[model samples]
Target chain A: LEGCAPCGELAQRLAFLAEVDRLKSVLRASLLCDGSRRENSAEHSWHLALYALVMAPHARPAVEIGRVIRMLLIHDLVEIDTGDVPIHAQNGAAHHGTAQLQAEAEAAERIFGLLPAPQGVELRALWAEFEANETPDAVFAKSLDRAQPVMQNIASGGGTWAEYRVTYAQLVERVGLRIERGAPTLWHWLSESAQVYFTARTGG
Target chain B: LEGCAPCGELAQRLAFLAEVDRLKSVLRASLLCDGSRRENSAEHSWHLALYALVMAPHARPAVEIGRVIRMLLIHDLVEIDTGDVPIHAQNGAAHHGTAQLQAEAEAAERIFGLLPAPQGVELRALWAEFEANETPDAVFAKSLDRAQPVMQNIASGGGTWAEYRVTYAQLVERVGLRIERGAPTLWHWLSESAQVYFTARTGG
Candidate 1:
């Protein structure tokens, strides 16, 4: 609307694209696997979408890769309004869930509504499916969403885990269960490797 | 292999994900619409993927949205090794083509090979399909790729165009033809809107 009138699909798409650039500024608790800095929500969504593509063949029940990827890509648009809440935060997660959900519902409407018709509805639905994490696609997407940060934390030498003072028990219960449910094999491999890092820190 | 052993699909996927984080460091000529800094290839790919989802309906021949999204996401990845070569560079475009191609081919192998089997092959092929720009999906992906920079350049007040000393005729031929071929409606609107900016600077 600033650059030009929203005349049609292209205009609407451009406006949405411009608006979503705000996502780059929204930071998260997870560090980059490289230890460079904290990963923003936009980069997290991008990485998870790429992970969906790479891990699609391994998904149990053979989920729809396209749907999974779309869900992953759009899932965090709500965070644009609500801001990122680290799931591992012991005290924060309890109070944040309902408020975050309420805020995100409004956020979804405002953000996805930036697009033209059909796309707005379609993307809103994709975002909702990802939130529900009900379908096979959403489940696999959620698994990658959960798995990536664990990998990042481990790669960065107990990154967010150390920052949040996370214990192995908390991680296994909070993050590992969803991952195991959605991607058992990855959970198997990841949990074994992650325990090595967690155990070393806890013992030391 | 560096941080952890590449023992299985999960390990391989995690390793490959870490390696591709290097894509974030690979910068391109185009500035963000915000004029903060140049966009990285990873961010560029992510934006184009989002655009593929948003613009799928407008593609003239009706491309496979999944494939188009995949192509767009993987296309610039070869640049992680070869470095971004601006498509519209005044002098460099003519001389750099062959060398850039050879370098990108090697980069594609090294980067995509980091993934697990079948996935490595599949992604490599997707990257190639995007490079060739022969299929409907690839064509549309390329159009979006080309169109994005134009929008950036225009939005940033003749950004790369002013810096590189690009002209109206050069832009029409170099960037517009492919955009027109892939999405004529967008091309029509873009060209008309863009001409105002170019003409203002060109005094035509």
Candidate 2:
């Protein structure tokens, strides 16, 4: 068992495969608002990760695009444990503030544990860094994660936020965390757009 | 807008991606029960669809493997609305089976609604067939979906089931529906296995 790095890697890989199989059990996890055309979480990751690649150029220069990509890719994994807390319900008074965070922390431990010692440690560390939001990369990552949803919700007629009556100002303020901590330019755009968004009638 | 097939196809594509994202999310979903190695839902769907393809020779002769693959691909979308109703918690009293079913129905409608137009309708229909368990293809899809978890839970020392005291007999009996309703041969193996499982660990 000492330095069973290769064995750990094999085990982790096998374990990953098993989880992958299980995940297929529930692909297009739909919300309560719209019916039938619900998107699966898997699609969400791929699409967002791609978005990170495509939109990186438009991102604030100082922020690390790679880190933001990573953050967006894995941000929603916690939903697996906590279930996809609908966008509409995110700001509810349920006080689940850190509950999802805690759940993801635990899940990350289990998932990353399967990898070989070195890879597991590294991956887990990356996840933790993103979670901590202390580093510039983490800040950038968090901002992008929020940004993707903003675009998506808007495209879908403000998807869940509209359903939930979330004001544009509130969303910008909420998402402004990225700028306050890291990307000021992106924040500026978001802030201005949010004012307009709030001022406009509920079009969707 | 009425019989738009493209809408269903677009929804189908989105569902595929979303499911994978869900798996990645699940890998880090639960702290208490999740294993160390995480698997993205996308990986899960790809693998299961592959499973359906590889195991096609093993399925009942008459069942439509293509339809089964579709079922396996999208079965888990409901988790987005209901969250992953862990196997342990599924049988509990609060589920209010009827309400849960209704809620899932509504959520499915919303999630799938994002697709273009015609594509959405087809995907919705496929999802419905899987849920209803009326067709031969759906039966096998349902069967494979149910069967994948059993082996994993067993290998992982019964995983969440052990924590929840899920009975061997109950799982076996559950498979009977698949056999009688889905693939007869698939059920044949499950039915036999259930007897042994029940005998070894009798009376939960």
Model 2 Cα lDDT, one tens digit per residue, A64-134: 65555545545554445555555336565432467766777888877667655675576678778877877
TM-score of candidate 2 against the unseen true structure? 0.45
True contacts kept of each: 0.41, 0.11
Q: Least lDDT summed over 10 consecutive residues: which range in candidate 1 chain A?
A: A88-97
**Alpha-carbon lDDT of model 2:** 0.54
Alpha-carbon TM-score of each model against the true structure: 0.93, 0.45
Candidate 2, residues B1-204, lDDT tens digits: the string is 123245444234334333334333433122211454434444444455544644565567778765566556566666656665554465534433787789878877876665544545666788888888777787777776665555455444455455566675556555456544554555554455445454666554
The model with the greatest lDDT is 1
lDDT of residue A82 for candidate 2 = 52
| Residue B140 in model 1: lDDT | 91
lDDT per residue for candidate 1 within A56-118, as digits (tens), equals: 767987698888888887888887788888987764365246877889899999999988878
TM-score of chain A of each: 0.94, 0.73
lDDT of 1: 0.82
